[model samples]
Target: MDVSYLLILLLVGAFATYFSGDKLASKVALVFALASLGMSVYILNLFNAGQNIDFLSAWITQPKVAFALKGDGLSLAMVLLTSALIPIIIYSSFGNEYKNAKSFYALILFMAFAMTGTFLAADGLLYYIFWELALIPIYFITLIWGNGDAEDRKKAVVKFFIYTFAGSLFMLVAFIYMYQRSKSFLIEDLYAMRLTVKEQTWIFGAFFLAYAIKIPLIPFHTWQAKVYQKAPAVGTMLLSGIMLKMGLYSVIRWQLPIGRFAAIEHKNIFIGLGIAGVIYGSIVALRQNDLKKLLAYSSLAHVGLIAAGAYTLTLDGLRGAVLQMIAHGFVVVGLFLIADIIYRRYQTRTIGEMGGIRQQAPKFTSLFMILVLASVALPSTFNFVGEFTVLFSLSQINMGYAILGGTTIILGAYYMLKMFQQVMLGETNKKAFADVTFNEGFSLVAIVAVLFFFGLYPKPIVDLITPSIEHILTFINRTN
Candidate 1:
């Protein structure tokens, strides 16, 4: 089967959903999202069976770009993450009504299409195109469906748009420079080219600017909290759950490999930056009153650790980063949905206003508690497996790095537990908060099931991603 079929399926789904009329649009979108997920699982099986599933054809002969879609274990793993989350995100939104619902639902699928393309594209230009394409749908989604003041929403979304677009231009320039050196834009061609220290430094810096902003590491994270707070629950989920992984994934797949020498030269500084985000994000998350913003900062901290692990350039580091990325995707989506659930009942996101929900809804509280525990990397949860491996990888570099990174778990637990206490415990609010409905319960169950199942036996994920990590590590350590 052609890998491009996945992209085609979503694109067609988006158009079909947009025309499906508002009442049926969401359901249509869900069907397509589920179909995309199924297709991804099938493709993954084919890949595991050792069948070739990549698609490559000429697109622009002059610049040497190709319309190419390639899948390996790593990319397919990310694809599966994107596919799996889109359906859940869509399903999670069922309780909320939106104006012009068809457009909103269609944008969700379109964003998925673009994100999946980013994971699968084999050419640098193609990857960059998909990377940028993913931005458009979300921009509209947030602006149109977002919760905050129109002006505030506009400011946050525009800042995100400009920051990301500006950073991407740097990446585009880097790719252009690489194409000049190699005469091709295919990832293999770029990966194979030998460049001077000066050239590698420039390339890595360009990619760093792009990925850092998207991942929103400490200094580049100014736009994140506001956007998350303002956007609708589903928009926040897409951004936190699957969008940020694009940056971390690019680091392992493109940045470290293509700019091995530069990454080695600047590993400490970047590693410090990642660890800094972890501590800083955790501290700031502790202070946030808005639930989504708190979750946004929490995501920053987790991805920070993931980025640090990738920079460690060891198999364990990269492998753990991928594992945590998948785990975080599911867990964070559940967290945001929990926030949405609260909002649906109390019509408020302020943590202080959300006390005593446990008195009202046991099932919702139980699921929320599981997510909170998973978020803190409780030993039996999926996050623990990833977090422990990431911290261990950092230890190989320096004990201090591991110690600093480990603060995420301690601080994550503290703030998450504190938030839970304030929000779910304390005086039972006079207002009655509804328990999780069937759809909400189903979504939470699916996420919790994945976390626990993988937490106990991560071997399947480990086996799937190890070879690919080893392959990428070759490029990362090629010159070292």
Candidate 2:
């Protein structure tokens, strides 16, 4: 049982898509994504059977690293989320033909390859390689296929590339320092080493800089909205749907277990930052006239709560954080895809210019409303499960932290429902609007179905990740 099949399936899909010719590239990519999804299902089943699907081989001997890839409950859950979303992402792109279509679809598959690798890599150096690998395709995806003013888009892409790349370099330096001390890049080796509080503090900062920029917490989130607005819808889905979780996943798998002392020491500081982001992002979202920009801020607010939950370092917090990561991944992709729909039909993302869409397209309106509700964490949606667990975890820390963090629900409902009203309600626009094409409708339906299904029965995911959370918490609770 090998977990690398997921990666191989995607990498092969990328190359296959490239040579499949433009006419067939998207279909080929979709098939590849579906294949990856099937492989993920098989891996999940094996996981349930108490099997370990791992692969290891020599990579770079000097670094004492191997091409080690393994799946525990945690990594596979992230992998499954990434796998499930890629097909929907590819399917969503069916309405329009991209220039250099083969290359475009190929890059999408390639990004999946890099991202799946990031989730499963078991060695620090291996993870770093995958981490850097994930950055390249997105730079090209945003730069080559993006929208908006060419100059502004270029600046946004470059800023993102530099900012994330710089953060990765910092993390790599920290890994190298740890490798020097432990003489191995295996995650277990890194975890086994005892560090002083000062040492843990610096390493924590290094990983924090990397993950924060990726999560784009509060002040570090300057790159997010512009990038989301400029990139094509498929690109936006990839970023919001899957790429952002890579950072959150790394925080759990890499940062906390390795730097447990610092995590305990500064838990309150990070938790406060997370709450600030929740309120700040929701308020800013309310002010955005652009639909994509509003969704961008909304994403920031939701992730802020998740990050705060992760910082709590409690079983409930970790459980909720992972659940929220999965829940947010589904809902945001739907919202952004809906924004892209408006952009395609009206040729404007300005919310003011759009109205009465609901009258014109009842089906679209209904689906959009459901996703909006899910985003605001309505009970019975998957998001509600995650949000409740996260808030409960925070309450255990302090009633104040829970109270402040809980504002995102009220604020999320405020901005999201308001945006829904402006975008979907009102009288039919003077200009004509068409209903969703089969392709678009299908993708939205599938995404919505997953949200509703998990919202009702989130027990499967919660159960699967609990043992792994407990495994990680052991180290987090240990003081040197």
Report the C-alpha lDDT of model 1 over 1-480, residue by residue, as the tens digit.
978999999999999999999999999999999999999999999998999999999999898889988899899999999999999999999999999999999999999999999999999999999999999999999999999699999999999999999999999999998988899999988888989888999999999999999997879999999999989999999999999999999999999999999999889998999999999999999999888888999999999999999999888899999999999999999999999999999999988887988988999999999999999999989999999999999999999999999999999999999999999999988799889999999999999999999999999889989998898888777853
lDDT of 2 at 203: 95
Tell me the number of clashing residue pairs for each predicted model: 0, 1
Candidate 2 residues lying further than 4 Å off, grouped into runs, are: none
Candidate 2, run of 10 with poorest lDDT: 423-432
lDDT of each: 0.94, 0.92
- Pairs clashing in candidate 1? none
Predicted candidate 2 versus true structure: per-residue lDDT over 291-339, tens digit per residue: 9999999999999999999999999999999999999999999988898
Looking at model 1, residue 385 earns an lDDT score of 97
